[model samples]
Target chain A: MTRLAGRIGRFAWEIALPIVVLSYWWLATADGDNPFFPPASRVLEAFWSNWFDERFVSDFLPSMARLGASYLLAVGIGVGAGLLLRLWRPLGEIVEPLISFLRSIPSAALLPFAVLLFGIGTNMQVFLITFVCVWPILLNTMDGVADTDPTMLDTARAFRIGHRRRLTRVVLMAAAPRIASGMRVSLSVAVVVMLISEMFASTNGIGYVTIQAQRTFAFADMWSGILMLGLLGYLLNLLFVRAERLVLSWYYASKGR
Target chain B: MAPLLSVEGIGKIYGEGRSAYRAIDSVTFDVNESEIVTVVGPSGCGKTTLLKCISGLLPPTDGRSVLNGIPVTEPPEGLGIVFQDYSRSLYPWMSVAHNVAFPLAGKGIPRNEINDRVERTLAAVGLRGQQRKKPFQLSGGMQQRVAIARALAYQPKVLLMDEPFASVDAQTRAELEDTVVALRAEFNVTVLFITHDIDEAVYMADRIVVLTPPPTTVSEIVEVSLPFPRDQIGTKELAEFVKLRSHVYRAVKNRWDDRQPGQ
Candidate 1:
């Protein structure tokens, strides 16, 4: 019972500052006649009117779909390519300059190229998000794979484990902590790139709705979209952390951290 | 009837001319089936290099080692190695049972047989029923036992132990030494053990191979005629055990002194 009461107290303390800031915003804008700065109440009202209906299905679902597909694609390709490149030194060297060149250019800047090639479809949007997100996973995987404890490799080899099992079961798991760290970084990148891709090439997503609200000067609607973006980013990170905890449970347990 | 492992004139050199370093000049020995042999040398006498060469982990620049009638150019089948650094060698991601079973995955053994072998091997190392725990959860001594269990589960024709008990406390080290001796009787596996401890070499080996320091070569090989199931207290206190220990100790110390700059 004390533990439960303590948890409640902690939760209230965590929300205290946010609630105070919210109240201050309400008091400061009580007159609520500004075009640029909508009162928190008006923003909440617009959030309901804009998002709690058809736009939720037409706009929000599409944004989430694109984010989901591109993020999965990036993680899969990143891990596969990372393993192959690290395992084979020559192959990694041959593509070193090409990877550098691609990584150097902001993936958002390639939006024009993406649109020209795949044309503002879901394909173009996905290409941009995946391109941006994959770099972190791939680079971190390379470092981790390269730095696997040599004694572990020696032990596996001495035991006559097959090449395939050694690579997948031994090498991959050894590199997982670094790979997971990179993945966490990319999850945030996936969220940001999802918005950028939608703002540029998307015809029907939350990013599109937000941009549309801004263009027509629906200030309350735009504020609501911004709030939703923050909410969604926070939610996606929470989900990623949960997934990370599950996959790397042994890692944490072994370290007793 | 033939020797199970023959480390015949194996040698290793690091780098090329001008900056060259000769780590092992020529190391030669033989271990017959089910026999235990220990190699003891002063620190940095290429004891590790010699073991790596024989186990086929590192390529010897000169000569070759033959294991079970096959020339060991690479890590051969029918061999298991337990490195001294037990913590790093055992996969932390794996449970103790999984770590033991990992090498058997590609051996095409049936599931039931593999489980049985894993359990039996763990029991041999005195780690039975602790299979669900991770390696880090165990003490250093227990962790090395898990490593030993992992090796013994493979049922290798030969087991190469590279100073495996060097990191454990003295009491645990003594227990592990006896465990290996006892397991040899059970498993009938040929063993090539490496160590810097003279007492360990005398206690655990049927024969002791002492090495001279760098450009390292076998200085002497002394046979230990002590009886099996040797006790830590009784066997170590035996007159024959002390004489053999001193003989190997003098051989190792003599070479160590020869290599000293101001001696």
Candidate 2:
């Protein structure tokens, strides 16, 4: 019971600052509101009105779909290309300069190229998001694969482990901690790039709704849109951390960290 | 009927042309089936390079290694190796059981059979109930035991060990040596063990094969006629043991001194 009580006390302490800030916003904007700054209660009401309705199906779902598809695509291509490039030194050398050149240019700058090639649709947004996120995963995966202990490689070879099993079991397993860290960085990049892509091109999704609300005089709805995005980003990160914890349980246990 | 392994005129050279550096120069030896042979040498005297060549991990620049009358162009399925650095050689992500079972993963063996083999091997190494523990969580000796267990589990006809006990404390090293002695009797596997310590070579081997310094070749092969199940204290006390030890030591020193500066 004391442990439970202590946990609850800790939880309350965690939220104490947030609660104070929210209360200040609520009381200050209770009545006399500027045209730009809507009352906090009205923003909450707008959040429910805009997000709790069927409109959410049209706006929120598309954003999630784009984020999920592009993120999955980036992970697959990044890991595969990373492994391939690391395995073939001559090929990696030939392509390394071009990869570095491409990586240096911002994804937003390539928005025009994407618009010309894929047009201002879901594909364009996805292309941009994937482009933005792949670099971290690819670089980290290559580094990890290259850093696999030579002795372990020799052990696997000496044991007569097949080529495929050696790659998956020995090389991949050894590289996982670095890969996980890379993936974590890419997750945040995916979120940022998703917003950028949607705001730049698509007329649908959360970014579109937020932009649309801001363009009009609906300050409360705009604030609600921003709040919804913050919540979504938080939720995605929470889900990612949970999955990372499960995946890297062995890594953490072995490291005793 | 034939020797289990033959290292006939094997040599290794690094780089090309003027930069070419010979590591092992014509190392030739053979191990009879189920015999424990120790290769004792100075550090950087191509001990590891010779082992790697025999294991087919590295191709010899000069002749070749043969296993059971077959030329070894690749790591033979009938051979297993335990490296000195157990911390790097064993996978950290795997549990002790999984590490032991790894070599058998794709061998088309039944899961139950693999489990049985893993359990049996771990038990033989005195790590029966510690199967679920990770390698890093164990002591240096235990980790080496796990490496040994992994090799033993593979049921290799020939086991190659490169300074396996060099990384552990004296107590653990003694325990592991005893374990190997006991294990050999039960498993009946031919072992080619490498070490820098002459005492270790004498204590653990049936025959001590001494190698000279860089561009190394077998300088001498001193047979150990010491009795079986030799204790650390009793074995060292034996007049025969002392005489054999000195003989092997002098052979190694004589070769080393022959290559001294100005000579």
Candidate 3:
């Protein structure tokens, strides 16, 4: 019962800031005089009507599909590249500067180039999302792998554990927490890039629907689309956090902190 | 027959030029099959450096260490090491059983055989019921026992320990010392144990090698002819045990005296 009460307390603590912000937003937008700030109730009404409609479902599913494919692809490729760099230091030195330079430019800035190369379609959005999300995962994985305790490595070596087993048992386990943290950051990047690419050049997707609504002065529809995107981002972050907790329970529990 | 392991005039000087320092200088020792050899010395006396050389973690600068007629190059297949810090020695993410069975995985051993070996080893270490627990979940002494079990399960020809019991509380340390004595007899494994405690050195070793301060060198080798299946309470009360303990204590004290400038 005490644990339940503590959890309830924590839940209330977490929602307090968001509740205050939402109340302020409702009060500020009551008159709906500002073009940018629509009334909160109007936004909610728009969301309810558009959310269940077939048009919204079609665009939402495609956007979600694109986001999922791009994010998974980025994780696979980024982790692979980071492991390769860790295994070979000379290769890491040669490519590190190039990776940093590429990561420095805003991913949205590459939309025109992406359009030129892959055309303004799902491919362009997928490519941009993958590009933007890869950096954090790659860098974090590299740091995690490199940071494996030398004593543990020596212990592994002394036991004559082979390279493959060592990587799987020791290296990957040690790196999981750091890599999970990186994936959380990368997921947000993936969602943002997905929306940006759709907004830049696309005949479909939630971003395209949002842009079309605004252009046609369908303010309520635009507000609904933006609301949906915000919800999607929040839901994705929560999922990643849940996954991290499941995988890294041992790490946190061991410290007893 | 030759000893199971031999270190001949082994010396290690790290780095070069102005940064160079000799960590171990002209240190030599040997361990007969089924014998327990303990190396005791003050801090920074290159005791750990000597163990590293014997276990093939670090190559000697001037001389060679041979194990079963082969020159020690890398960490040998049948050699196990238990470091001082138990927390760092065992992989934290793996369960105790998995950590123990890790060394036997690719050696053509069957799954059931691996499980049996891990269980038996954990049982031998008095940790039979805690196989599923991760190393971090255990107490410090328990973690050290898991480390020992991991090493023992490897069935190494020689077990090299670097101050394995230094981190635990006094009571746990005594129990672990008893555990090591039991393990030595049970396995008939050649043990090269290192410690800073005089009494522990005399208690756990068949022979004790005392080392001087850095640039460290072996000062004396004391033989402990205590009978097997030794009990801590009775053994500590023996006249022979008292004499040997005092001798080692004085030898260490003398080394400390000699180390001071103009002594």
TM-score of each: 0.96, 0.95, 0.94
State the TM-score, rounded to 2 decimals, of chain A in model 2. Answer: 0.93
Per-residue lDDT of candidate 2, residues A1-257 (tens digit): 99999999999988997899899999988884487878888999999988888768998899899999999999998888888999998888899998899888887798889999998899988898898888888988899999999999999999999999999999988888888788888888888888887787888888888888888878898898899999988888889888988887888877787
DockQ of 3: 0.77
> Which candidate would rank higher by lDDT, 2 or 3?
2
lDDT of 1 by residue, B1-263 (tens): 78989989998999998999999999888999988999999999888888899988999999899988899978988899999999999999999999999988867899999999999999988887899998999999999999899888888999999999999999999999999999999998888999999999999999988899999998988888998789999998999999998898889888889888999
Which candidate achieves the best TM-score against the true structure?
1
Docking category of candidate 1 = high
Q: List runs of model 2 lying over 4 Å from the truth.
A: A1-13, B258-263
Which wins on DockQ, candidate 2 or candidate 3? 3
| DockQ of every candidate structure | 0.84, 0.76, 0.77
Winner on DockQ between 1 and 2 is 1
Query: Which pairs of residues collide in candidate 3?
Result: none
Q: What DockQ was computed for model 2?
A: 0.76
The number of clashing residue pairs in each candidate reads 0, 0, 0
Q: Cα deviation in Å at residue B75, candidate 2? A: 0.4
Off by over 4 Å in 1: A1-12
Cα lDDT tens digits for candidate 3, B1-263? 89999988899999999999988889888889999899999888988888888778888898888999999989997799999988987987788998899889998989998998799889999997998899998999999999999999899999999999998999999999999888888888889999999888988889999998888888899999987777788888889999999998888888888878888
Name the lDDT value of residue B133 in candidate 2. Answer: 91
